[model samples]
Target: MATELEECFHYFGYGNHLSNIHLHNKNALKVGIGKLVGYELHFGDFPASSSAKNCWKGGLASIQEKPGSVVWGVIWKMNQTDLEKLDRQVMGYRAKDVTVEKVDGGLISCRVYQLSEYIPAAPSTKYKRLMVDGAVENSLPNDYISKLVAIEDNGQTGAVDATLVDSEETKKTVTNGDGVHTSKAIHQSEGYFLYFAYGSNINSKRFSVSCPTSQKVAVGCLKEFCLEFAIKEQTSGEKFVGATIESRLNASTWGVVWRVDLTELPKLDRQEHIKEKFYEPVDVSVDLENGESVICRTYRVLQPYSPFPPSVLYKSVIVIGAEEHALPAAYIETLRSLPEGPEHTVGPMKSYYLEATKN
Candidate 1:
């Protein structure tokens, strides 16, 4: 933590890092809202941590000056340690000191980055969604978010290969209680399969019944997908509330990514009612909070509970998971504010939740 007078600097993040949900996962301590005066946010080729050339290349974001324009974002207070983490996060950009007018009517001297080399290109659709989500989460001007949504994919190929990745930032060196070194496994490795859980699975206690050791590894966002609770169960014909992502190019779904053992695949399928056709597996890629990409599998709705509200009991399960993993505050509020129906069919599922939360 930086004190009031010890060289604490305000760092403005207008892109994906602007979301406190994303930043806190990266160890950023947001101080307040900031408006970068006399500058505009633009996309171009620079640096990246993901291997998706088309999705990440020639369209990353940086700030450019527009005489009368301003970009809005979160003001983060950083000490030396936090500064080092950010340096690793923005490798190919040149940092410059800029005075940002604080939203609270104060002037803050902060550091903002500019691309070292600007290559005109369009950003990925997913990338655009990230910026829009961040802007909304940070309470930036609504017009700026509209502008981000309007950026179409330039579709220009030949994104110059990033020269800075495979650097120190990409490595995770950890040793455990057994003196065995284990960095996280990649998506769908021999023994693990990454599962994206946006609903009841968000609640670890409930998910544990399926995969006992299942743990959410990272917070991720999927573009153009919205969560809907219309999926109905085949056997019960009751609203056994759950979330299935629907495609909506202008929307996004936030969730937790979990690494499950391959052996548990059968069990998870049973729990999700693959036999009953409630949900079917869908392979997709999601962007992690650490600026990296992971290929994961998520379930999509195959049935409908049609014209019914979610039971508060089932909704609370997801709320617990989001809280357990620290999702974006705004997204959580959205979950909490959703309209719910009666605890209509409180059978084994409700008892299971009661026992799960008890232990």
Candidate 2:
């Protein structure tokens, strides 16, 4: 049966003219049955003509050739019943005389039978689809980050219940603590901090609720890291290089930092989904408003199969009602104008912007 199919292909100059062709359906039956449905063959870069159609009338079933291209494939929707009838009426041969078996979804096994003698053609250089990188640049808005933190701090099941303070002073300041101005000295002396995030947590309404006292800043940084994408038991898919940049204060880089009671650190860890096995807290240096630098803690993914490639995302969040300094614009620009990454890329995660350190 295979010999017959090969002869037909040679006579029709299929192997030489067609590019990549494959069967669309994978779950096709294997055994040679008496009657079954035909195959659907996909050919890329087919010529727009009916030349192959006029050549073989009996064997040819249907052909779909795109216009203005030199690529084509055939589908022979023949069943065992038709084959048996053709053997008795058209060709003086019994069904047992011809070898017929199910090869694959797109091909059928056949014995020697030729309409015309022709030379086998060489393989064609045509492809089905081109490869593309799914990378994009996304800047995180400050309001969105605040909302995310609020959602995270609040419960995921319900909408956040944040109220605007009614004090005139609170309305004027970006960092008023929900209209509660008890101690003027405490409000004046409290320093602000920043933290940067570049991941699924970019949905800031949730993150803000998680850190209600923190404000979303419009600063970012560019950095490279490795991560994977999976749900529970799926294996590795594709490796990518991700980028991120920190927002700047005076001449230094600033990130989102939270100024909370020391006891809230544990809650922050949980809200950030910081499992010991998957992520670890690390201290890094960032720039402040007056050219000074400060050390801040951030979380990094430590899982084995993370698909986070080298790409960039915003990561800085601001703290309201705090006295921390900020980094300069030059510093932020330096981080943004980094060179184009190597081949593979990933990510456009959210970033934080915070006040600079006091030194």
Candidate 3:
């Protein structure tokens, strides 16, 4: 019987390329010592280890490291059967879970932590200084401060991409001391509004490359909603629920909200792929400081055309930094009461829109 790792490699056209098959006790931990045999390795996150470097070579191998380990890497050559086996094994691994997909004429696999196994760690405060990368330095527009805040607070790792950051010279020419005004001008003279985003975009720096003027709002509640969306073939057709920030009477969610200029709304709309006939904007009340309230527009799929049933969509709002505050129990229960879709019904999916509840 082929091992799981072997099966995964084969399914993705790497079966023959894999040879050395090595498996360590799932819980073993040593810097480099372990079973070595026909195993193929891929290195990420762990850079300096010799074992990680050996993975690039297609063959059998062993590595020795520390004892009483909590993570193990499975190395092997795989065919279709082997890939399937690996898939099953990966699903069983608690600390990390992975799925494979075909992309750009090749198979790619992504590994991430399972929700139950994920633990929030202390946030990093160190700012990355730009030294050698000219492209990166040139992209830091005057608004880079806000962009930096977004990136740091969101826990994103990586240098600011050129597409997102403008050069210092550009910043000097664009702003007359006001960052928001420069952003507004670029957004084309439209009224500014806030957009609350919790998921992938939380790494605000990355998100800012796409929306430079957005701000990291400090108030809101995290709401989990069953949203039927698809990413590049990587997600394996699994409909995942995403958390969004909302406002409630007793508590609020924390999240990054973009103070977007109206002119840029059209571009954002295009990016979100919102169409008038398929979606509509609805008003949502958000908690403000000092016992005040602000209404914001959030887009939801209209009746009949949505893909998933409401029961699966649990709405939990995020309060930007307040991960401790639980969303209203009533809101979660209410989501459970929503109806499910009709046996995988298909139609044009509804997209979201931006609406300003205030002037």
Scored by TM-score, the top model is 1
Per-residue alpha-carbon lDDT of model 3 for 36-147, expressed as tens digits?
A: 1222222122223222211111121111223432212222233443343344333312233233332222333433222122122222221111110111212222232233
Q: Over all chains combined, what TM-score does candidate 2 have?
A: 0.26
lDDT by residue for model 2 (1-359), tens: 44544333211112211211111111212222211123221222213332221111112111223443221122233333334333322122112222222224343433222222122221111111000000011112333223222321111111111132222333343222111112211233345444554433333443554566655543333222221222111124433432222222112223443344434445556654344223434444433344554444455443233343233222222221111223345544544454433333322122231221112
lDDT per residue, candidate 1, 1-359, as tens digits? 65654745668778756652232234457888888888988878743453323225447778888999888888877765566666656767788999989877899888887777756667764455456656665557666767776778654322123343333432342222211111233233477778888888877788888898676789999776788877365575654555677655457788988988877876777776666656666555677999988867777655334535567777777777788889999999999998888786443478766655553
- Give the winner by lDDT: 1
lDDT of 2 at 234: 19
Q: Give candidate 2's total backbone clashes.
A: 90
Q: Which candidate model has the greater lDDT, 1 or 2?
A: 1
For all candidates, the clash counts are: 1, 90, 76
> Candidate 3's error at 27, in angstroms?
68
Using lDDT, rank the candidates from best to worst: 1, 3, 2
- Report, for every candidate in turn, its global Cα lDDT versus the true structure: 0.67, 0.29, 0.30
